[model samples]
Target: MSSHEKHDVETSSGHDIAPATSTASNGLALKPTALERERAEQLARLPDPDAGKSPEERAEIDRKLMWKVDLWLIPWLSLLYLLSFLDRTNIGNARLAGMENDLHMFGTDYNLSLTIFFISYALFEPLTNTLLKRLTPRIFFTGIIVAWGIIMTLMGLCHNFAGLLAARFFLGIAEAGLFPGVNYYLSCWYKGSELGARSAIFFSAAALAGSFGGLLAAAISKMDKIGGVAGWQWIFIIEGLATVFVGLFCWWMVFDWPETARFLSEDDKIRLQRRIIQDRQGHAATDFDKKYIYEALKDWKTYGYMVIYMGCLCPLYAFSLFLPTIIAAIGYSGTTAQLLTVPPYAVAALATVTVGFIADRTRWRGYCNIAVVLVGIVGFSMLLGSGDPHVQYAGTFLGAFGIYPTISNSLSWASNNIEGSLKRAVAIGMIVGWGNLNGVVSSNIYISTQKPRYLTGHGVVLAYQVLFLLGGTIFMHFALKAENKKRLSGARDNMNDGLTDEQKLVRGDNRPDFIYTT
Candidate 1:
């Protein structure tokens, strides 16, 4: 028998099977290309990896697979994020526990420390995200988490302002990868609609940590003088140790790609991969190309998302990092102010998850974003208009509810609208990295000298809400609608008329088959 003929042999089941290469309609030999051959082999190896499965069966399989993915992945990522958030914002709690006097932070030193952390965070975030895919999610994420955890623990050892500043700067570098990396990783698994709620659940851990951190601080503050440590030191020591432990645990738990998930059957893995490809409509679904990075950089929507995200995060971070201080400034003092921070964060967590659920189900992300920002506008107006502590406290609740929802919405919105994995990676990273520069703005806006009302801070945040409402909500909604219309009108058919399949794949979102989601 010829080598090709031998390759076509079948089993005793009597099914007729052709060799890998066959004849085309014009009688030329039709051999599989490298990409096609790899895809075919991947499908063939997966147990029962057929699209002919019944809808009911497919649904059942997908449901089980999603549950498994969620179970294995979500808890660990959320826990790590919870700790990341706790460590990040715990400086406020530490301040309440006497870190300011211990380290002799004066004037704008505290503000500068916060500003420096964000500067390092913003500078490193995109670089870390670009490295994440290359390093693999499991190693990159766990390594950064461990690094930050160690930095956080060592914060307790810092006896001077310079020591705290250095620790915070490095901590920012270590933490830059996590939040965006998790978002990029989720885009690998979930569809556009599924992303919002999942992102919310993941992001909500920050608020939960804030509330939990308050209670933890209250308890830990009483531990002053144990092992020659101050109460603030204990707060960092205990929380940082907990974060390190979670990071170590997650090292073995995180799955970088769906196909590599050990908990999944071969058939389940194939289906998981197929579902995301279908969801994204073949826009950079499975491969990485350097051109996608350049394309994303040139895309205007990337920066638009970044600006809107900045608007949202400015208020969110200000609120998270200074709620205790804000409360203390409003006449509450000692642990009472620390305890008061819990409610706003708790309320914010509830608001965040609820809106995320609604946005996913309704698919009204653009409108949802606008509506939430308006709620914050009202909150900020109230804060600016009132002098009553009770009224100000109510405004805090409103502001918390408004800002927290936007984190998930804006994240999922960017992830939803951008196509192609590498493009999305750069886009998400840029959005997050650039947006967080607002942290520097936020850190400075609430100056100690401007306390009691901080009219400038409230006014600045309110103006941002209006800007996002106009640019991010109204403009993006109409722009996406116009683009989708242009694509549907078949106006770009001439551009790809002579292109091969491989060339078309290279077009990414510019492909006629691609439609931008609003």
Candidate 2:
């Protein structure tokens, strides 16, 4: 194969994407020719209606394309995430449905169990993501989902503390790669401008799962007479079956990577794929090196990012895993509690979509992060301040809405700031890994004493929101400062120096140039 042909992926019509070439002797790839580099850059910077793919004249074309892509991506993803999240979170619903009594968990044992899952999940996330380079993300991804799905179903069968812990630990292991892998894959398909909204659209599945889980539990609790199985058991069996089925289906549906997708036509592949690398102002990085990961760690921005993301697990877990219990305290039965839980997630899903679209249109991410966090604080504080069911329930919307930015902003920020090819790969992994470390802390916040009113739980969650908002500010501040630093550093210094972004893969991170979009 010619140099460019080596990188080529084919479309359905057997059309080939433009080939990329590398000059490096090392395993790392160097950028292609200057002209090829330029083409990649142009593609990246193309204004949305990006490249007029869906021009004003072709509204139907746009709709059809969106549907075609979403058809495969959305259902499978929604099902995948719904299952994982529902299983992880059903503990909350199950808690209210009588898990605490049957399991003999008291004080904070349940909360501790929830927190433990994240510990294993956070610790292994980076390791699993790096594995993607070697693993067929499709196979690798599906394997984990299927394993976890079975584990979730088995949670219903647990008779004691040990059994529950064993299930959660394996559940953590199987579900580890999911969030980061999908985030990385999405980055491959969509440009920075289009990603935020699409990301939200994808993530909203979790919220929907949250909504439906409540309803499922409500109905299941009514089936309390089935073989003496608790309502929580039904929650597990149903969601787990759905997860396993959807996971099997996802392998057939999801695009493995841009280069490997089965759907796009060759011309569309050529046109679509070529656009990203070229969009870089100039230069590309090639080489798969440990150094990229190191530099990202060295970069203080990683620390700043950790703030918003790291502290997130508490609020999210508290909301997802403990929500049913929390809502149940508002003086409702399991069914009504489940039904009420739906609104918060339903509202959250809507906000996720709306904010993503607006953020995409404006090309502003930090502002959106800040705005969402602020609204979330309102929701969290309401829970802290009131005991009235009406008031506390209303706060759920704000809380759910606040989290819309977790995926949208985090991944978008990484895509904007990360420059080199290997660096982009590694940086995104760390972003997810380090940030999720907070899940451990987030999980343990809900204890038995905190229940009914959960004064401590509410306080801790509110405090987490406060921390995340501060983290958001720091992220924007550092992002702006980095851009300023780059500006003062003066013009970039190589043939690849002025290369297009797509060409970046060839640049082998020698600290190749990148602009941090504030």
Report lDDT (CA) for all predictions: 0.79, 0.68
What digit string (tens of lDDT, one per residue) describes model 2 on residues 142-188?
78887888888888889887788888888888888887777666555
What's the TM for model 2? 0.83
Indicate the residue-level lDDT of 92 in model 1. 91
Q: Which residue runs does candidate 1 get wrong by more than 4 Å?
A: 1-53, 283-288, 492-503
TM values, all candidates: 0.89, 0.83
Candidate 1 per-residue C-alpha lDDT over 1-518 given as tens digits, one digit per residue, 9 for 90 to 100 = 22211111111011122244557769898875433453455446445575688989878878888998888878777888888899999999998889999999899888898898999999999887668867788889879988999999999999999999999999999999889888877766776668888889889999999899999999999999988999999999898888888888766788767777788887777777655534434333333466777778988888888878888888878888888888888898778878899998898888888889988887778888888877888888888899999989999988888898899888887777775666777788888888888899889888888889988888888877788643677788788778878888987656677878766655556656456667
Clashing residue pairs, backbone N/CA/C < 3 A, model 1: none
